[model samples]
Target: MKLFLYVLSLVGFLAGCGGGGVDSIADGDPSYVKVRESLREASSRVLDGLRIRGSYQAEDVFHVSGCESDSKEGGGKLWEAAHFWQIDEVNSGEVQSSIDRLRDSLEAQGWTIVDFARPPQVKNTVVRAQDPKAGYVVRVIGVQEKSRVAVRVSAPCFRASGDS
Candidate 1:
């Protein structure tokens, strides 16, 4: 896990700094199929940063969100691609470590860390980061009661795969 984190962080950093290396996550006017693939890959890359001792499940791959109420410039409804990867029910400390690693990885990849809150007292917290170019964001949550971690990657609003 440490090695994966180190490598991912480095790759992310380079990608963010215009390297456009293997970890770069940017797509413009992507179709539904393209967005789904991107979202799944993004979510998996994020899950790779976790240092969970136990295993987690990503059986569903990704969850498709309803289209936005408003349309884009061309008047076509927008779609959202997102998914949640839940940790294997670890302790608070482990969950925190995972969150830290996730934040580091995203920052390294060139995404902007917009919001991060893990107040010592607050068990339920979130860390949000966005791809400066595409505006896609990843949200990491620490569930207090479950003592687990859940990471969500949400792609920017996009048109249907077959549209345009």
Candidate 2:
């Protein structure tokens, strides 16, 4: 009888821990939510003027410094978009022109043009469409210092049938 009671108590304790454990729910971090909202807002602005065949998907990740130390540490993912382009016969100048057009459009909306590269990297997500059937992805990172808001924009390159 004593052994049975001991076993029951152990089981109950384990069950309770599992139900109310720290890992059960997220930390409810406000920073993450803030970053996400900011990304959504920025992405909407960036995509305002563009020829996209479909909708855009923007994902953002935020990192904060000084959380563990004296200095502030932070990182984030802004936005991503998919586009289709012809790869067989596109020239560099044409691609540049397209990018320039997009850049100008974005800038007109008050987005700061940080850097433009042929093949975008962590710092840049813009890609030149080289294949007719192939598509390019674009990503942009920007921040609204006032609200500590950041955004990354990415989209695929879509070329008209006769355009490319």
Candidate 3:
């Protein structure tokens, strides 16, 4: 009876230790999707305003900025974590002005600006806009207690024809 109990206990322990049985969560969740959609909508609005002001251009790529990092947590290491957008730009002042309007627009949409800084990885230029330009990331916690969802949007400035 003692040997049998020991065997049963070992089996129970082995079963309990199997992979934790937790559901793997997808990185892209609904909240993140919604945030991304909202940002795209906001981008469209900015673009429309720029167009109305005669600054829209087809060559521009609205750069959304974020971060990458490697750090250890628990027994594992986290490879990357994107920060947020930090700037916006266009070939004309009208596009820049439209992006400037984003501060209020995002706030109204339930996002709070945590902070801002010029990313060092980018080469700052008086004429050309930096890559991963300027903007902010909006975040929401997921259904899982530790998960997060975010959307980043950025716009970088470019030179007009006359300026050197």
Candidate 4:
């Protein structure tokens, strides 16, 4: 009986580690599917016109605000969905133009450009945007050394504490 109980407890703990068994849309959960789809759509806009050279990754994550009272008891917590698309290689000369186009598109869609940095001061060109109403942010990092560009879009978090 003791061994049986121990094995059961172990299984339960492992399951919880995988997000309470609500891993992804492929898990057949309708709500998860919707959230994943929405995040993908938002992220795709950021990668528009970019040639994908490497792998793409997307997932749901719990963001910790460092206000967690017990850290385990959940003092501060937010749930988010995000996606990233990485480009194979960036053309050295076209970095500026690419950033310009991305900035224009994001601005046209009502996203506010928070920060944009170019070469000389920084080796990589970076663009960050935020949507106040939607509560999401997007970042585009152009790595000159790696000759790659990565576009990431993160959804507005759902606070666990119910605080706005």
User: In terms of TM-score, which candidate is strongest?
Assistant: 1
| Residue-wise C-alpha lDDT for candidate 4, range 57-160, written one tens digit per residue | 22223221222222344543434545544554566656566777888888888889999988888878889999777867888888777766766666665433
Ranking the candidates on lDDT from highest down gives: 1, 4, 2, 3
* Better model by TM-score: candidate 3 vs candidate 4: 4
Q: What lDDT tens digits, residue by residue, belong to model 1 across residues 1-164?
A: 53443344334323332221232222332464476556656766677766565446433244444456546567445566665556656865777777888888888889899988876756577788998987778888877667767777788876653354
The alpha-carbon lDDT assigned to residue 71 of candidate 3 equals: 30
Give the range where candidate 3 is weakest over 10 consecutive residues by summed lDDT. 141-150
Best by lDDT: 1
Candidate lDDT (C-alpha), each = 0.63, 0.31, 0.29, 0.55
Q: Write the per-residue lDDT of candidate 2 for residues 19-108, one digit (tens) a residue.
A: 213322111334333333343343343344332222122222222211112222223222222211111122323433445565677656
Give the root-mean-square deviation of each candidate in angstroms.
Answer: 9.9, 21.4, 22.5, 11.5
Name the runs in model 3 displaced over 4 angstroms: 1-71, 81-91, 115-164
In angstroms, the error of model 1 at 73 is 4.5
Task: Provide the global lDDT of candidate 3 against the true structure.
Answer: 0.29
Residue-pair clashes per prediction, in order, are 7, 32, 11, 1
